[model samples]
Target: MTHVVTESCINCKHTDCVEVCPVDAFHEGPNFLVIDPDVCIDCIACVAECPVAAIYVDSDVPASQRQFLALNAELARDWPVIVRKREPLPDAAHWADVTGKIDHLQHP
Candidate 1:
């Protein structure tokens, strides 16, 4: 199973996980990051790096956030690959623990 970047990642866009991904499976969006399922190695390296705890194995994604699996897949196809860690959004700390931010996700 692949890891999915869930709603908690929206607007926060922490890239710590990106740096740990062995396959460079992460894709960058305007305010989010998604893992390309086809490229993820199921290594689980990104999960612990996420300060917001937003990365989950596809099988472990909460039912409420299940849609993220498809969302990650769909967006990864178009977003540019992100291989380096970058500063998170300026408001990341403010948004990190906030719940239900799906509508705030920014696509590019």
Candidate 2:
């Protein structure tokens, strides 16, 4: 299974996890990231690297956030691969803990 990037990463957009992905499965978006299930190795390396705990194994995703599994897959197809770490959004700290952020997702 692939890992999913969920609501905690909405505005945060932390790239710490991207740096740890061995297969380069992470994809960048305007203010978030996603994992390409087709390329993800499921190594679980990126999960612990997420500062906001936004990454989760597909089966472990919170019930409320399960949609992220499909969301990641869908967005990964359109977004560019992010193989290096970058500065997070300016207000990352402000939104890292906020929940119910699906509405804030910026689709590519």
Candidate 3:
């Protein structure tokens, strides 16, 4: 199973999890991050490092944010490897831009 980056991550865009992921499975999102299910290895290194506790195994994803499970897989197919992820402050000031954008970025 894959890990899901939940809505909690929307404003809590800390990138430390990305820093520890070994497979380069993490991808950039407008206000958060997405994990590549195919490459994740279910290592869960990202989950423990997430300060806000935004990451979860797919089966444990909260009902409201289930869409992210699909979003991750869809985005993974095309997301580039992140060579140097950095810690980021909460994007509370700019989260208005994240809504509905994932629907437009699909996997080929």
**Best model per TM-score:** 1
Give one digit per residue, the lDDT tens place, for model 1 in 1-108: 899999999999999999889999999999999999999999999999999999999999999999999999999999999999999999999999899898898775
Off by over 4 Å in 3: 90-108
| Cα displacement (Å) at residue 24, model 2 | 0.5
- Model 2 stretches with alpha carbons more than 4 Å out: none
Candidate 1 regions exceeding 4 Å error are none
Error of 2 at 59 (Å): 0.5
User: Arrange candidates by lDDT, highest first: which order?
Assistant: 1, 2, 3
**Clash total of candidate 3:** 0
Q: For candidate 2, list the clashing residue pairs, or say none.
A: none
Which pairs in model 1 have colliding backbones? none
Q: Which of the predicted structures, 1 or 3, would earn the higher lDDT when compared with the native?
A: 1
Candidate with best lDDT:
1
> Model 1, residue 29: displacement in angstroms?
0.3
Root-mean-square deviation of each candidate, in angstroms? 0.8, 0.8, 4.2
Error of 2 at 95 (Å): 0.3
Query: Residue-wise lDDT of candidate 3 within 32-98, one digit each (tens)?
Result: 6788888888888889887767799999998877888987787666667564666574554464345
